[model samples]
Target: MFALRRLSTVALSGARCKHSLPDLPYAYEALEPIISRDIMTLHHQKHHATYVNNLNATEEKLSQAISKCDVSTAISLEPALRFNGGGHLNHTIFWETLSPKCTEASKDLMVAITESFGSFDAMKELLSAAAVGVQGSGWAWLGYDPKIKRLRIAQCANQDPLEATTGLKPLFGIDVWEHAYYLQYKNVRADYVKAIFEVTNWEAVSKRYSKAAC
Candidate 1:
C-alpha cells in the first residue's frame, strides 16, 4: 500500500499547483451498472472540471489580494478558496474511490474496521446510512483520526474537505450530491449510495488508511 499523496496534494497544494481535472483511470463505462457512462462522463468532464477551473480563478484572485497585503480582501476570498478548493479536493478523492476492480480490504484495514465498527459489513451500513442521511448535497467519509489513532465515520456538507474541516484524514469518501447519482439513479440517492461499494477500489482505500495510520 502506498501513501495517499494525491489527496495530500489536493488538500494542501491545489491552489498552488495549477489544478486540472485528472483523467479517469479507467474507461467511463468501466463502472457500468453501478454508474452509467453518461453519469460518469458528465460528473468528471463537466462537474469536476468546473471545480478545477474555479479553484484556479479563486487562487489567482487570492494571490492578488496577498500581493497588496490586503488582509480584508484575502479574508474575503477565504470562502471562495474553501468552496472551490474543497470541491476540487473532494472530487479528486471521489474519482479514485471507485473502480471496476472489486478489491478486498487489506488485513490492516479490516482490523481497523473491526475495532471501529465491529465488522466490515457493519462499517458499510454505518457509512451508507451517513451518506443517505446527508440533508442535501454532501459526502460520507471513512476517515482516520491521526491524533487519537482511530478510525471514524463522518459526513460533510457541500464541498467541505474532510481534513480541513474535521482534522480527519479521509481514507474513503462517497459523494452524495444529486449530480453524482441523479441521472442514473434519479431521486433514489440511497440506492446509488449503497450500490457504489460494488465498484469500490478497496486497494486504494486501504492504501489511504495505511498512510493515515502512520
Candidate 2:
C-alpha cells in the first residue's frame, strides 16, 4: 500500500539513499499452481534483488557526478538509472498486485473499466494483446490517466516505468519478461499472461485506481 520510490526522484535528491528489495507479501509457494515456487523464488531473490542492488549503485554514481558537476557523466548514467530504477519500481508493484487468493475487481474499478473499454472482458482482451505483443522484455499495464479521468492500457519496453515514460498512473501491470515465466511456461508467453490473471490481486489494483483516480 506504500508508494514506490521512483529512480528519477532518488537521483534528483541531494542525498543518496540505498534501495532495498521489498520482501514478497506471501511465501514463494503461495502463488503456485499459477506461478511456480521456483519461478517466484528466483524472480524475487535473484532478478528483483539485482535491480535493487544496481539501482543503489547507480544512485551512488549519480550523486558523485552531481557533486563533481560532471553533467555529462550524469547524463550518460540516465539509461542505467532508468533501467534499474524502473525494474525496482515495476517489480515492487508487480509483487503487490498479485495474490494467492481469489478476488474480484471493486465495483468502482469495474465501472471505470467498462466505461473505458465497453466492458471488463474487453479491457482484459486489450491488455492481454498489449502484454503478449511486447517485442521483447517489457510489461503491459492498466493505468489511470488523471487528466482524462479514464483508465488506459499501455505497454513499455524493457524496464521503462509506465508513469515515467507515459505519464500514466499504474493500476495493474503484467510483467512479460522471459525471466518471469520462461522456467515454467517456456516460450508460451500468452499462456503465462493468461494464467497470471488467476492470481491477480484485483482488490489491490482497485485501491491503486482509487488513489490514482482521485
Candidate 3:
C-alpha cells in the first residue's frame, strides 16, 4: 500500500509536470452577468489550457537540453518557455483574482490602494484606462513596486509576466487578450473593462498585496 501511494504521488506530479490547467475555483458561469459562460469555458479550457500545455512541453525540452548540456538547444527553446510560461503564470493569478459579484474591497487592500494611487476610484480609473487602452494583445496589472514600497498599474505586451518584465510583484492582472472578452463584448474592450469590476476579487488581491509587501 505504501508503494502504491508513492506511485500515485509520482503519477500526479508527472501529470502536473506537463503543464496541466489549474481548475477554476468556481463554475464557468459564476462570473455572469459580467462574463458569459461560453467565453469563460473557452477561455479557460482552450486558450489558457493551450498556454499551459505548450509551456509544459517547452519546459520538458528545456530540461532535457540542460541536462545534456546542449546550450544551443536550450537557447532555442527560451522564447517558447518564456512566452507560454509567462502566459500560464499570469492567467493563473488572473483567475484567482476574480469572482462573480461586486464584492467590497478588503479594508487592507483599500488602504494599500489609497496609499499607492490616492484613492480606490483613482486606482480604478488608471487600471481601467490601462486595460482598455492596450493597443493589442497584452495585460494590465496592479503590481507591488518594492523600490517605491507602493502599488503601481502597468501594462505588458503579449505574454510577458509583470514581475519578470518590470520587477514588480503582481497583485492583480486584467487579461486584455481579445479571447478574454471578444466572445462576450466583441470589439468594445471598454465594456469588458467596465464589467470586470463586478467580479474583481479584492479579498484575494489584498492578500497578494500583503504578501508582496512582506
- The number of the candidate with the highest lDDT is 2
Q: Least accurate stretch of 10 residues (summed lDDT) in model 3?
A: 8-17
Clashes of each: 0, 0, 0
110-214 in candidate 2: lDDT tens per residue? 999999999988998999999999998999999999889999999999999999999999999999999999999999999999999899999999999999998
Q: Residue 204 in model 1: shift from native, Å?
A: 0.2
- Against the true structure, candidate 1 has what lDDT? 0.89
Model 3 C-alpha lDDT per residue in residues 30-81, reported as the tens digit of each score = 9988999999999999989999889978887776666555899989997898
lDDT of 2: 0.93
Better by lDDT, candidate 3 or 1? 1
What is the model-wide C-alpha lDDT for candidate 3? Answer: 0.88
Compared with the true structure, what per-residue lDDT tens digits does model 1 show for residues 12-128?
A: 544566888999889999999899999999999998999889889888777766655578998998888888899999988888878997788899999999999999999999999
Q: Which stretches of candidate 3 lie over 4 Å from their true place?
A: 1-18
Model 2 steric clash pairs: none
What are the clashing pairs of model 1?
none
Compare candidates 1 and 2 on TM-score and give the better one. 2
Runs of candidate 1 with Cα error greater than 4 angstroms are 1-15
